[model samples]
Target: MVSGQLFNHKLLDVVFENANYGTIIIDNNGKIQYISNKYCEFLEVDREDLIGGYIVDFIENTRLHLVVQTGKSEMGDLQFLRGSFVITNRIPIFDDKEIIGAIGTIIFRDLDDWKKMNSHIKDLLARNNLYTPEVDQANGARYSLHDLIGNSHEMNELKERVKRVAGGDISVLIRGESGTGKEIIAQSIHQLSTRSTKPFVSVNCGSIPEHLIESELFGYEEGAFTGAKKGGKVGKFRSADGGTIFLDEIGDMPLHMQVKLLRVLQEREYEPVGSLQPKKVNVRVIAATNRPLEKMIENREFREDLYYRINAIQLVSPPLRERTEDIPLLIQHFFEKAKARIGKRVNSIHNDVYELFKKYSWPGNIRELENVMDAGVHLSNEEFLDIDALPEYIKRDSENIRRDSEKIQKKTLKELVEETEKEEIERTLKNCKFDKNKAAEALGISNSTIYEKIKKYGITE
Candidate 1:
C-alpha cells in the first residue's frame, strides 16, 4: 500500500511538471508551496526563489491569495503578465468543510497560444456573421434594415423613420433598453445610407479602457506611447472615412473623450494621438445607449453638448414588452433560424410556449428571445418545442403568474367560465410541456385558436 501511494504521488508530481499549462499551488497562508517548472519558466524565475516565498513577492496583480482567503474560484480571468495577457483559473481548495489552499492554472502556455486562440475566436465570429442576417453583403455593416424583424406599429414607424434618415448624413442617437437591437438599427442606417459602399466601423465606448479611448477613436501617431503600433494606428474615425462609425454605449464614454467626439462632430476633423495636425474625415456618427442620458446630464456624468450633437436624429428602439404583438413573429423567426442551425427536425412550437413568452416581460428584449429559442432548439428531443425546453427562469416565472392568478375570485357565470378555461389551458400546458401541438390537439382546437384563448385568458406556461 505504501509503495502504491508513493507511485501515485510520483505520478502526480510528473503530471504537474510536464503539463502544457503553467500551475501554481499555495497554502491558505498565501505562501507558495509548489510552482510547476512550466510556471517558473513562464515567469522567468527559479523555483527556489518562489517556493517558500509569499506569492506577492514575485507575481504582480495576482488574486490567488484572495481566492484562498475568500475560498472562491475565479475562472477564465484575463490578467496582464510580462508584456501580454494570459487567461488564468484560480481555484480555492477545500478539505472537509475547511479552507486548505488554492491552485492557480494558466490556460495559455505562452502569449503566442493566447494570440492564436484569439484569432481563431475572431474567425469563428466572422464566419457566424456570414450565416446570420446581422451582416450586410454590400456595405460590410454587421446588420441591415431587413434584419430588424417586427410587425408592430411602433416597429413599423421606427423602420419608416430609419428609411427617411438613411439618405442623410446627420448624426443619429439610438436610445433603448438593453438588448433592444440598438446596434442593429445603427448598422441598418449605415447600410441604407449613401456611404453604404464605405467601411462601417463600430466601437463600444464602454469596452475600451479610458486612457485608450481617444487613441482608438482618432488613431495615434508613431511613438504616441510606449507600445503604440509602428507607423501609427488608424482609429475608427479614419477607418470609416466617408462612411459611418457606430459608437455603441456612448453614454459610458468618458467626459474628456466626449469633448473630443463633440469636436469631431462639429468640425468634421480630428487630431491623432501625439499629432498636432488635424486630419479631415467625412464620417457619419450613429451613437446608441441604454443609459438615461437626460438623467446622466442632470447627474453631470455625461456631457450636454455631445448629447445634443448626437441627438440630432434620435431613434428609440422599443423593448419587447412594449411590443408584445411581435412576440409570435419573433419566436417563429428565431425558432426557424435556430432549428436550421442546430439541424433540429422540429417543425412546430406549441401555443403555450408563445403564451408563456407573451406573459413574461422580456427584460433582454429580442436578444434574450433569440438566446431562449436557440437553447430550446438544442434542448428539444421531440419534433416540436414545448414548455419543457424553456429555460428554468422562464418556467419559474410562469409558475409564479399561475399561482398569482389562482387568487382571483369568480363572482359571475362569465367569470366562472373564464376561470375554468384558464385553469384547463394551464393544466394542459403543464401536462404537454414537451409538445404544444399535442396540447392543442387534446383540447379539440386549432393551434391558432389555442393561441387566441391563451391571449384572451392571459394563460402562461
Candidate 2:
C-alpha cells in the first residue's frame, strides 16, 4: 500500500513535469524569479542558471521588455530557437490593478502543422499546377476590378453582367481602348470565377514574334529547338489548365497561329511543339483586343470561326473619358498609393490640376492617368500638384478647352451643342421625371440610354 501511494505520487509529478507549455515568471525589475522545468529544458539551462537572471540575458529580443513595460499581453509566432519555432503569449501578472510582473507561455508549433492548411488549397489547384506566391505577388500591381471605380448606372449594369458571365466557363472577349483596362476586366473575370485559386496566366499575343508564337503557346519538347529547356516545356494553355489563360491583344496573333488556336478551341486539346502526344487542358480562354475583330475578319487578318468561339461572352470596358465621373476616385486612390510608396504627404490635388485632368482626353485611359499622376508626384515640391507640374498634353488640352468654353458660351455653337443637350434632357424630365416612356420620346434616345445617362450624369431635380 505504501509503494502504491509512492507510485501515484511519482506519476502525478511526471505529468506536471512533461506538460507541453514552457512557463516563465519575471519580476518588475526585469529579473526572472521562477521558470518551470519545461522552460529550463527549452532554454537549455539549469534552474540555477536562469533564476534571478535578467530576462534579456536569456532572450535576445527586447520586445518582451516593451510588453512588460506597457503591461499588455503580447503574442506572436516566431522562430524562438534555432531549427525550432513557437507561438508565444506573454501576459502581465497584476496585483490589485498594478502590474507587478509578467508570466509567459511558449507553445512550440511543428512546421508540418501548417502543411495541412495549405494542402486543401493545393488539392483545389492540382489540375492547373500551382503557381508560387512570387508569381501572384508580382502580378498584384493594383490592377483589379477595384480600379473600375464608378457608381454610375451603366457601370453597375456592366458589373452585374460581368458577374453573371464570370460564374460560367464560357470564353470571354473584352473590347476596350489601349489603356482602358480590358486586361484588367479579364483578370477580374478570372478572379471572380471558380478558377480563381488557380493560375491566371497572361500572354500578349501581339508582342510575340511570328516564329516564336507557336512554340510559346504550345511549348516545345526537348531538342525540339536549339535553345529549348532540357526536359519538355509546358505551354501556356497547359500551364493554365483548369484555370484561365488571358490572351491580350489577340487581334495581333498571326493568321497561321489563329487557325491553330481555332482548332484547339474547337477540340479543347493541343499538342506541344515537336510532340506527338496531345495534351488536353480545360482552360477558360479570356481574350482581349482593342481592334474590331469583325473588321479584321473582313480584312482576313482574323478568323471568323475563332471570333465566334471567343465571342461567346462579350464585354466592352468604356474609355476613361466616357466614365469621367470616376476620375476623382481614381485620382484619390492613386495619390494615396503614390504618397505611401514615395514617402510624401501631399495635402490635396489642385483645382486647376483637376480641371486639366477633366479636360484632357485620356487616349491612354487609366494607365495614362496613373503615369501622369506618377510624374506629378515625382516633380512636385508643394503640397498640391500644380498645373506647371502637369504634362504638356494636359496643360495644352485644358487651355484649349477653357478658351473654347469661353468663346462658345451663350453663342450659336453652344446652342447647337450644350444647350441642345441640356434643353432636350430638361424637357424630357419636365413631363414627370418618373415617366420613362415620355422621357425617351422627349429625348429622342432609347429609354435605356436615358436611364443610363440620368444616373451617370446625376440628373436629378
Candidate 3:
C-alpha cells in the first residue's frame, strides 16, 4: 500500500509539472500544497516561495480558498493577477465525498493568450456600437406631412387621406411618377403613426443587388456564406420591429423576393438566411413605387397576391404639372429654403420667370422645382431671380413659348381668342409631354374635353 501511494504521488507530480496550463492546489486550510512550474512562471515566482504558503498571500483577488470552504466550483471566471487578466476555473478537490483541498486552473497562460482569443470579439462589439446610431438615423423618418408643400385640391384630399390612414396599422402603397415625393408622403404617414418613436427602417428594394437582397432584408448567420461578418447581422425587418419599414421602390424587388415578402407580410415572421429559427416582428410596412403594379402584374413582372397584400391602402401623388396652381407657392417655399441653405437672400422673382416656370412642364415634379430654385438662388447676383438664372433647358423652352405668343397677336380679335385657346391647349399638352390624361388634369379640364379639343384642333405629337 505504501509503494502504491508513492507511485500515485509520483504520477501526479509528473503530470502537474509537464502540464500545458497554469495550476495550483491548496489544502483545506488554504495553504498551498502544490504549485505547477507553469503557474510559478505565470506569477514570476519561484516554486520554493509559493509552495506551502497561503494562496491569498501570493495571488491578488484569489478565490480558490472560497471554493474549498463552499465546496463549489467556479468555471471561466476572470481574474486580474500581476497587472494582467486571466480566465480561471476553481473547483473543490474531493476525497471520499468530503472536500480536502481546491484546485485552480488558468485557461490562458498569459495576457497575450487572452487578447488573442478576445480581439475579434472586441472588434465586432466596437463595430456594432459604431453602426447602431447610424442605422437608427438612416432608418428614421426625415419628413412630416407639412413637408408635402402643395395647396391644390388633389394635394388637400391626399393630405386628408394620409391623416386618416396615419392612425391605423394597415399597410400603405404610395403610387406616383418618379420624384413626386412618394417617399415624403410615406415618411409623413410614419411620423404620425403610433410607431413613430420606434425605428423607421427604409430599404430601397431596387438599390440592392438581386443575389444579396434576401440576406440584406433577412440577415445571415456568421460563416453562413463567404465574406459574412464575424457575428451575424440584424436585418432590416428585425431592426424595424415594433416600428415602420418604408420599402421604397418595392415594385423593383425580384420575383423570388416578392414571394418571401408576401409571406412575411402575411405571417409577421421570417427566418434569416441560413437560420432555422423564425423571428417574429411587429412592423408596419409602407411601400412606394413609381411603376404601375397593375401593369406589372398583367405582364407577370410582379405578383398579384403581394400587390393586394401591400395595397391595403393606396395613395396617389399628383404630378407637379397637374398642380399648376401650386407652382407659385412651391417656388416661394423652395426659394426661401434655398436662401437659407445658400446664405443668399432673394426677396423677389421676376414675373417673366414665374410665367416661364408655368409654361414649362415639370416632369420631375416638386423635386425638379426645388432644384431649379436652388440653382436660381445661387446664380442670381440681383435680389430678384431673372430669366438668366433659369436652367438652359427652361430658357430655350420659354423662348419657344414667347415666339408662339407673338404669332398669335397678328390675328383678328375673334381669331386671336380662338388661336390663343389653341395655343394654350397645345402648350399644356406639350408641357405634359403629350400624355392626354395628365394634360387634361393639368388644364383642370375633363379627359373627354381634352380628347375633343385634340380631335377638333387636329393636334398631333
Candidate 4:
C-alpha cells in the first residue's frame, strides 16, 4: 500500500501483472490506471495492453466510471463481461470529498469459478437453513426450444410465443398445471434469449422455508442474522446477475418475500441483509406457477403490483391432456431419453403401451409420463416395454379408460335415445296407472309413437 504517485504503468508493472485477484484501478475520468493479471485473464487480454485503455472499451456494461464521478461505492454488484456475471465492487477514492480514482474488484472469471465459490457458500448456508441452493449458477439453460417437442397446434403456438418473448428483455410468467413442464418453458426462453451465455438460476419458491426465503433470495452480510456466515452469502439474484432466474411455484412465496421480489423487479436493485446499500442487478426473471395468481390477489395472498411486474409477458404451457395428439411424440422422446440415460438395451415399446398412453388422461402431464417411462425402463429386463412393466395404478387407469371407451362404442345414438324414451314412457305409464292416452300426453308424444318406441326398446306390460 504505497501513498505515493505510483499510478504510472511501468512503476507497478511487475506487481500488478502477477496479482491473484481481478483488480482494476481507474482514474476519475475512467481511464485504466492499472489492471491486475487475473482481470486481464478474465478479460482475455494482456495486462500491458490494457494498462492505459478506457474501461468502457473492454467491459460491455460497467459502472465503475460512474462510481468515480458520483463518489458512491457499489459492492457485491454484478457486471456482465464476455458471457458471465462477474461479482464486482467499485469503491471511489476521495480526498476530502474530491474524487481521485476508483478501485474495482471482481470475484470470478467464469461459471466454473462461480460454481466453486457458490458451492462453498451453499455448504455454509445449508447447515443453518436445512436447504441447499440451486446449482443453476453452473450454467445457462439446460433445454432449448426444440426440447418442447410437439407438432400440435397448441404446441406450435406456444413455441412461437416463446420465440417472440425470448427476443425481448422483459419479465415472463409461465402458467400451467403441475408437471406440465413450466420450468422447461422457462429454460427454453432463457436458452433462446441474448443472455443465454450467462447463468440460469432456478428456485422453487414453495420448496424453500418461509423464514429463510429473504436471505436466500437477497443474500445477507456478515453477522446479518443469527446464522449469517462470516463473509455473508450472495443470493440467487446476485448469482443470476446478468442472466435469468426461474421462480417456480411463485404463488407459494410468502407475502413478505413477494414485496421484496416486487422491489427488485421494480427497482432492479436489492439490499442484502445487514447491508444498507442496495446492489444493482440486471437479470431477467421468468416465474412459473400452477396456482391462480389473480385469485390469490383477490384473497390478499399476493401483491397486485408484483403480479403486473412479472406478468409483462405471459405464456401458458399447454396441458398434456389437451394436446393428446403429441402423446406419441412425447412418448418416443421420453423413451429415447430414458434408454440413453439408463444405458440399457431396452430398445422397444409395445403397441399396447402406446395405445394406453394415448387413451390415458395424463392428469399429471408430461413430467408424469417421463417418470413412468424412466421407471419402466429401469424395471425392464426385457427388450420391450409391455403392460406388465407398467405400474399397477397405470394398468388400472388404462383398463378403466378402455372399459369406458368400449361402453361408448357398444351403443349407437339412436339405440341410446330409444332406450331413454322407453324408460321414460314406462315411468310415465307407472305414474299414470299404465293408461296409454295419459301416458302419451305426459310423455309429450303420440300414443302410437310411444307404443312403437316401447316395442322397439323391448318394453312390455
Task: Order the candidate numbers by TM-score, best to worst.
Answer: 4, 3, 1, 2
Model 1 residue 237 lDDT score: 92
TM-score of 3: 0.61
How well does model 1 score by local distance difference test? Answer: 0.82
Positional deviation of residue 129's Cα in model 2 after best superposition, in angstroms: 27
Runs with alpha carbons beyond 4 Å of true place in candidate 1 = 1-138, 410-461
Per-residue lDDT of model 2, residues 121-216, tens digit only: 322342244422233443332234444567766566776666667656789999888987787677766655556657788999988899999888
Error of 3 at 168 (Å): 0.8
Can you write out model 4's per-residue Cα lDDT over 360-437, one digit (the tens) per residue?
888899989999999888887757999888888999998898897788789999878866777788898889888888
Every candidate's lDDT: 0.82, 0.72, 0.81, 0.81
For model 1 the TM-score comes to 0.60
TM-score of each: 0.60, 0.60, 0.61, 0.62
Lowest lDDT 10-residue stretch of candidate 4:
129-138
| Model 2 misplaced stretches (Cα beyond 4 Å) | 1-143, 410-461
Per-residue lDDT of candidate 3, residues 1-461 (tens digit): 01235224356668876665688888888988777777877677898888768999999999999999999899988675642346789999787787888889886545345444333222233244531223224547777666777788999999878867775689999999988999888877765555655778889998999999999999988888889998988899999898899999998999999999998999999989889788898999999999989999999999999999999999999998898999999988998899999999787999988888888889888889899999999999757999899888889988888898887776689887776788999999899899999999998999999999889888999
Question: Model 3, stretches more than 4 Å misplaced?
Answer: 1-139, 408-461
Q: What residue runs in model 4 are displaced by over 4 Å at the alpha carbon?
A: 1-137, 410-461
